[model samples]
Target chain A: MRNSIDTGAVICSVFAAVALFGAGSLLALMGYLVLKGLWPPMRALAALIFAHSGDSLLSIWIRSLFLLLAATLLALPLAIGTGIYLSEYTRQNRARELILSNIAGLGEMPPVVYGLVGWGALAPYFGEDRQTLVIVLTASVWLLPQLIVAAYWALQEIPVSFRRDSLALGATRWQTIRWTLMPYSGRLLAAKTLEGMARVGGEAAPVIMVAAAWPDSSKQPLHILPYYLYRSLIEAVDPATTRHFGAALLLVLTSVCFQWAALRLRRTGVVAGDTLPGLRKR
Target chain B: MRDSKLVVRNLSVYYGDFQALRSINLSIPLGAATAVIGSSGAGKSSLLRALCRMNELWDNVRTEGQVLLDGQEIYGPDVDVTEVRRRVSLIARHPYPFPKSIFDNVAYGPRLHGIKDKRKLDEIVKRSLKQAGLWNEVKDRLQESALNLSPGEKARLCIARSIAVEPEVLLIDDPTYHLDPVSAAKVEDVILELKQKYTLVFATNSMQQAGRVSDYVAFLSEGALVEFGPTSEVFARPKDRRTEDYITGRFS
Candidate 1:
């Protein structure tokens, strides 16, 4: 008993230390970014928000939001459909395993490869006039594999008994997926989608290959936060450092908001009796 | 038997390379409670699942041989799998109330078969819940989430849900495995009552429960049927040494 108690205490202390370290690092980073980044760009951000005219930080932030929404809208249905097909309809076979392995491989491929594909392959068909469309398509392609994997895992996380019970009640496979599996995994799917949106909001490489660096007389203006930050850093000037920091701050804020929304959704689902009664007590 | 509701011939079940149930033949009587009793991993649940084709839901699960319901082969190519399931439903040991209201949980089966009239659904739900002996406790809270019910209530609610579709056979796989003694007794009572109407095939680990609730008992040991006969005769006579030992508490 004494040895077990000591071991338990040691495990608890180790976990506590890890938790403290993570929280401390996040706080330190946020404090530094707020002091250095938010302060320098406060006036310009305010002006951009109010005027909505030029390619300023806030304008780029809004544009990033738009791109994130558009790309997510394009990718979500296809990813969910593919996920459902893989998880529910297919039996365990060599072909299914091969397809899943390929999807996993695609998820790990660099975003720059997707950007290169968009530039070399799709640009000619779309022509120079539809650069924004190409950029949106490239971003959606990058986001698709990740979202598909997310959706598959989310559906997998539902208890097998739900499917069994539904089927035992004479529900068709489609009805089971529609009524039980979808509702039970809805919050998880939404959380994953939000996390994906956070990632796409801050992605720079794919956008750069498809979008022009700066707004020129000949080029269409396509300002997003990540591209703005990339440009600011590459300039390598003192003011550019502050601008990049500000952009970094905005990206971090967007990610934090997405994470917060995900957490809030999970909590709200539990409170609203989305979880099983047996699990709710725990 | 001429009165048999379901006939199983050379039934074998395999999960990957592991065979859970060996080739076994049995006949379940109509409008009577037949108990499949065995110890853990003794293929009782497999037999129940196989009766209604529920075993096919799992991946890598291969079921062989024939299961006939009312002289019709359920595994035949022309048979509608969904129709078979609707005709013969399995009530799992654990209750899984969908994340829906009590009314919806019971109405789920009827609705799946395309019953859209609200009045008809309401009547079915009421009758089913009443038949399961859960109507008095839950009638006021029919709109409440089924998850909020106690363990015993949830078990009965699952029974209610299963019967709402009015299936011919009710294959209950250890309905009281997770319930307390009082709750277990209550579920046993519901099972006893249900046998008067539906052809009930119950799988259990308890010999006493088998004696209490079943008219005919099929004793299984290690994926094979050891003995099967009327419960009173099987309890008294030693047709097989293993069945005699099991009923006498010499071994599980």
Candidate 2:
């Protein structure tokens, strides 16, 4: 009160400022999206979202989930392993520096670029217009660098003392990483996998390039959400398309679900120097 | 010629061409507590590290000389540095506990040397922790993470870890620098008691610690071993003027 007016007033003002800032940005974007996009399509929502189109929405949701899950399985382990190898096994040298810089550069490459590369290289080798497997392959390569970078950063954030301590205890290099490094980095690795999932899920360009898009129920090679959305937008007659909005909502919900799981795992993962049960002295 | 358990002869260490330690020679008796007393940059820690072969872990760090354990050249061409380190373990100045449970920290050394029997591991862990004077404080929390220990407890845990493998020689580099006087005194007491089982060589900046724990004392200055004798003789009646100046705190 003596220094900066009343404490209560200051607290109230700070809360007011924070609330305004928090709600202002979201309100602005949601207001714009509703006014410009969702509202413009509102009259057709019931027919577009809820109407059962035989196997249309179901097929798209299944394909998208399948591709996302498959790619995650294929890429996640390799990416995490490479990340650990680089961060722990490979000390800083000219070659290690070169490899790390290459990873960063690969991560920055656009999705479209990856699409073209996959089309030119992988698609030809595996044959084009393939099923969900090719889509998985493309997604694996596209998300690998990002996952590796995230994991590498997570491992690097681990204090060097942790490793030194492990070694000092006569733990072998691999043992130290397994017993100490991996557990400590579990949260960040899980979070990175979630980020990679989102990247893989939303990828539209690569699937389109390698897996040809057909709107017909049986012919769409992988019929992932993005590919289906693009097909309904560009090829299918706009007003007559049956399941686009529902598919969109499903994709959004799936992303949200995966993100929630990631957050939960992050909360429970081993923290830096986390104490064991029944050990907290005070 | 003295019968010594550990012999360091003409040992020189360089970190990327900057000499960290010059030609140094000292002999440490078996099952005795020897302290290296010096100021910072006095090569006390380097000498201790060379004894355990831990200095080879660094890159662009070169050493010339012989560190002998029981009269066998430890750093010789055919010697396994890993095996040497396992036989002669070191505890650093600052306590760095692994990101693991306290039990795992103490069990690590035995596990490395292929001791997988859980019951044996348990006994070693308990014995080492007890010897480090940390058993009472952490017995109930053996499964707790080592990093969660207090600074003093962490230091003690490190000592326990080093001793778990039943190493023939224990090297402690500035073992109490990060500790308070009380905790430092406690660790010093542990070190004194530990010498009965293993040859103990420690580096300490505190002359009082050297006098208190060391059966033999070696005075090091500017990367050289200036004087070496029994602790009482070195402290009570100095042979070299520099040793007297250093011991009396007239100069470091």
Candidate 3:
């Protein structure tokens, strides 16, 4: 009773089911972590992320937060600018294709590759331990491709006619971009920036390889949440060991909070899949 | 109106390896509404863009011609495309208001030209909106987002936005094509009103609209100027067969 058309439909349905199951499995994993995470004591969690005295969790959390902020400030403008140039200025061609392909390749490259690159690049000028500002900068560079892709897509979603319309109305090309494209794409760019924050915020491998342990005593950087989690789990005594789980909970919560902020932004019509009051009617 | 004369001599346009418009000669008088009517691919839009130097925006589009606005060459080396466009604004086939409040959309062009006085800007916004016939509907809600307007209102808003800058000429490319008959009629009325202050050059497929609003008619075919005269004379007795064919609906 399987007609030729029905066979294709059956195959497509099986593929769709597989895709859904894969998505559901990831969702379930995050859901489980969040469910278990809320049960921990907030005091312990705070101590884990904030306390700095002698292997205290707070110091480690602060280190990670510092690194994340440093990376964000350094990386966002370059990444967003690259995305804009590629999406707006460059005509479609081989060079554009090659750049996009490289961005995709860089996005998937292992965190350890960036760690190694950071180590080599920073060792001579900064030092060997990848744990300071250098490592954070490196990790952000690693995360740059993702931010650019997101920003590019957001910019692309704005119709070309919008730019042309403004220019036709006697606005300079830059003026048109500033007044029209930038304001419209503002939410999307912010969302993309938040995504970059989350990516750097959650990562552990690059942070571990590049970040230095506490008390170089002169210049200490790159001791972030993930690195803190690793350091506490491996180096701390049993009494202090509870901090690792707490740090894990903190990192997860930070990422979740970042995502929640992005979602809230989207809901408030600051990001993609939302429309601003300026563009909804016609 | 002293800058009334626009002279085009030996204008030719090419798209990559293909020629789109042959040697073309045309003149437009200031303060008169000229209607360019032709079939698709007749290079009507190309000619309009050429006048504004917007054709230069396309990499593959090459023009070898002289377009002079008030005896000064528009395509000359020293001419600023931005300055030319500031004097001669264009309305696209589709209407797109800037992504801003109705008041801000009207305020954009003036702001760009460094008109920082908010009160003067407000007056310009209101007056422009009034001239475009959108003031009565949107006056109270000027600060509200422009995206909330109906399609006709949005198109009028675009016109109002252009008028805010007080351009010398307004080049409208088929503003009513996508509109329903009623909205199209309303827009046409706005155009008729607008022709008093600005030199209006409008492209359209509708012969009826051309007859109604145009002071002069220039019929084009295959990228060549076929016939042109006062609107009343051309429509009543079109000299060219192509113009006759187009007017009678025998062919595009």
Across A121-186, the per-residue lDDT of candidate 2 in tens digits comes to: 776676644655567788888888988888888787676656655565556778777877888787
Name the docking class for model 3: medium
Candidate 3 whole-model C-alpha lDDT, 0 to 1: 0.78
Clashing pairs in 1: none
In model 1, the runs with Cα more than 4 Å from the true position are A1-21, A24-28, A37-44, A93-95, A212-218, A236-245, A267-282
DockQ of each two-chain model = 0.65, 0.35, 0.62
Please give, for residues A100-123, the per-residue lDDT of candidate 1 as tens digits.
Answer: 888878877887888787777777
Q: In candidate 2, what are the lDDT values of residues B1-252, reduced to their tens digit?
A: 236999888999998878888898878988889999988898888888788876755656799998889889998889876677778888877757766689998887788778999999999999999999999999999998777788889899999998898888888889997689898888888998898888889999898889989889998888888999999999999899999999999982
DockQ of 3: 0.62
Instruction: Write candidate 3's Cα lDDT for A1-282 as tens digits.
Output: 669989999999999999999968757765665454434565655554466564555666566677778777777788778877887778766888898988978877877887776666754466554446577677778878877887777677676667777777777777876777777777767776786788777887775655532334334354567876676667767753355566676687678788878777756552333233343311
Instruction: Indicate which candidate wins on DockQ.
Output: 1
- Model 3 chain A worst lDDT window (10 residues): A273-282
